[model samples]
Target chain A: AQSVTQLDSQVPVFEEAPVELRCNYSSSVSVYLFWYVQYPNQGLQLLLKYLSGSTLVKGINGFEAEFNKSQTSFHLRKPSVHISDTAEYFCAVSDRTSTDKLIFGTGTRLQVFP
Target chain B: EAGVAQSPRYKIIEKRQSVAFWCNPISGHATLYWYQQILGQGPKLLIQFQNNGVVDDSQLPKDRFSAERLKGVDSTLKIQPAKLEDSAVYLCASSSLQGGEQYFGPGTRLTVT
Candidate 1:
């Protein structure tokens, strides 16, 4: 079985400040990693994904994540955040050798303040 | 392109009552999925459909939950005699490929009183 863990439940940052949301996963086999953002009462939107390329992947909205295989982690990063960036973020994993069934972590609420 | 669509954006029912949710996937999507998200938790897969056939339903509660995708476009999920634990957001997602990125719909929030 595969599982995802988001180390922080909530992260608070001021506008124009850098932000990082931590995520870790446990899987017996290789996996695909993804980060998704959800606005209030809205569905999730893909931030970025790591399928089969470089260790560092850039995503929408100036977000990026690095897939660290040795650490079993895929942490989302943003050099700067805006007030509109306040949303709930999720980390998901899918088994590489098996079906593309997403296993998601609880979530991290990003509260960008002015 | 239009994303996945789900009906009954909000549903409230008493315990033991039944409820159903409808979803319409993207025009050419070949894969559809249903997920349940409890409060403060991430979404959990309930079932997966490839066209009109079931691809995965291991986590779905067979006794109380049932889902079907007819004509490989529209889908429906039903829960009979709903429980309090079933109160959560039910999301529908679709993808062009089995391993492709899924586009999610605004979930149906079901509240069982």
Candidate 2:
């Protein structure tokens, strides 16, 4: 079985200020990690995924995340954020045993202030 | 490529009533999924279908919820005797290849009074 936990429920930051959203997971075996963003009144859109290779993965809109095995964390990072970045973000995990299904964390709301 | 499409973008019904939502997957996609998203929460998988066949439905509320992918193309989800707590957004997603990033539709937001 797999589960995800997004520690912060809401994160408020000023525009152009860097930010991080912490995500942790528990899986008996290897798992794939992903980050998704949803704007107000819209559906989720894939931001980035960790499948293999480099520990750091980058995605759309200057967003990136690092997959840390020892820490069991996949924290999303952004050097500079924009007002448009205000949205809800989710972290998800899927194990090698069942890649078809995903376990997602309760989302984190990002409020970027100008 | 075209994104997933869902009908009845918004629905309002009284308690004990029945409601249904529709979804059309992207062309040639072999996988379809239904998810429920309540206010202030991430979407939760309700059911999955592969080529018009059921793949996983562990989280589906079998007693009051049902879904079907008759033609392996578009799908429909139903909720009978809807309750106040049943108000939520029903999201439909599709993936061209299994285990890949899914494309989502605008979703049908249901409000039960």
Candidate 3:
């Protein structure tokens, strides 16, 4: 069984400040990593994904993540955030074989203050 | 292209009542999935279907929950004698491939009082 762990439940930051949301996964087999953002009362939107190749993957909204194989972590980072960036971010993982079954972390709420 | 569509964005019912939610996946998509999201929690996969066939449903509670996808297009999820715990947002998603990037719907929020 695969699982994702997001150590931070909530992160508070001021506008224009950089932010990092940490994520760790436990999987014996190789896996694909993804980041999703959910706005209030809306469906989840894909932020970015790490399927293969470069460890550093860039995503929409100027967000990026690094897939660290040795550490089993895929952390989301943004050089600067805006007030509109406030939302709940989720980290998900699925094994290479069963990519349809996504295991998600608890989610970290990013609250951006003006 | 239209994304996944779910009907009755919000539903309210009493305990032990039955309720159903509908979903129409993106055109030409072959894979569909249903998930449950409780307040303050991440979405949990309840079932997955590939071209009208069940692929994975190990996490689904078969006793009170039933889902079907007809003609490899639209799908519906039903709950019989609903419990309070079933009061959560039911999300429907679809992907062109079995393991491709999934597109999610707005979800149907069910409240049981």
Candidate 4:
């Protein structure tokens, strides 16, 4: 079984400032990590994933996450946040065998303010 | 290619009433998933299907919720005797066999009163 945890339930950041959303996971077997974003009233959008190899993974809309095996973390970071970056973000984990049932953490709401 | 598609978009039903939501997955994607998302919470998988056969339904409320993917192309989820807690956004997602991102639909929002 795999479980994901997003430490912060909400994060506020000033526009043009950098931001990070922390995520951690626990799994008995090797796993895949993913970040998903949700606009108001819309379905989730895939941001990026760490399936294998590289510790750092870049995603759409100027977001990236680092997969840290030692720390059990996959934190998302952005160089600069925009007002449009306000959205709900989710962290998820899945096993590698490819049956691929994702276990998601309670979302973290990002509020980018001007 | 079109993303996963779900309907009716919104539904309002009284307590104990029955409701149903539908979904059509992306072309050639063999895995389909149904999830429930309450406000301020991440999605919880309600069921998963692999080409018309159920692979996981451990979290589903079998007494009140039932789902099917008869043709392996389109699927439907039915909730009988709806509860206030059952009111939430129902999401549908699909992933191709290649093993990567899962495409999602604009989920159906259900409100039970």
Q: What TM-score quantifies how close candidate 4 is to the native fold?
A: 0.96
Looking at candidate 3 chain B, the ten consecutive residues that score lowest on lDDT are: B1-10
Clashing pairs in 1: none
B32-77 in candidate 4: lDDT tens per residue? Answer: 9999999878899899888899988999999999999999889999
**If ranked by lDDT, best first, what sequence of candidates would result?**
3, 1, 2, 4
Candidate 2 vs candidate 3, DockQ winner: 3
Instruction: State the lDDT at B13 in candidate 1.
Output: 100
Show model 1 residue runs off by greater than 4 Å: none
**Candidate closest to the true structure, highest lDDT:** 3
lDDT (Cα, tens digit) per residue for candidate 3, span B1-113: 88889988999999999999999999999999999999878899999999999999999999999999979999999999899999999999999998999999999999999
Per residue, candidate 2 scores C-alpha lDDT tens digits across B1-44 of 77899999999999999999999999999999999999877789
Residues B1-113 of candidate 1 have per-residue lDDT tens digits of 78889998999999999999999999999999999999999999999999999999999999999999989999999999899999999999999989888999999999999
Which pairs clash in the backbone of model 4? none
Evaluated against the true structure, the overall lDDT of model 1 is: 0.95
**CA error at residue A42 for candidate 1, angstroms:** 0.8
TM-scores for all candidates: the values are 0.98, 0.98, 0.98, 0.96
- lDDT: which is higher, 1 or 2? 1
Query: Per-residue lDDT of A13-109 in model 3, one digit per residue for the tens?
Result: 9999999999999999999999999998888899999999999999999999999999999999999999999999999999999899999999999
- Candidate 2, which segments miss by more than 4 Å at Cα? none
Specify the highest-DockQ model's number.
Answer: 3
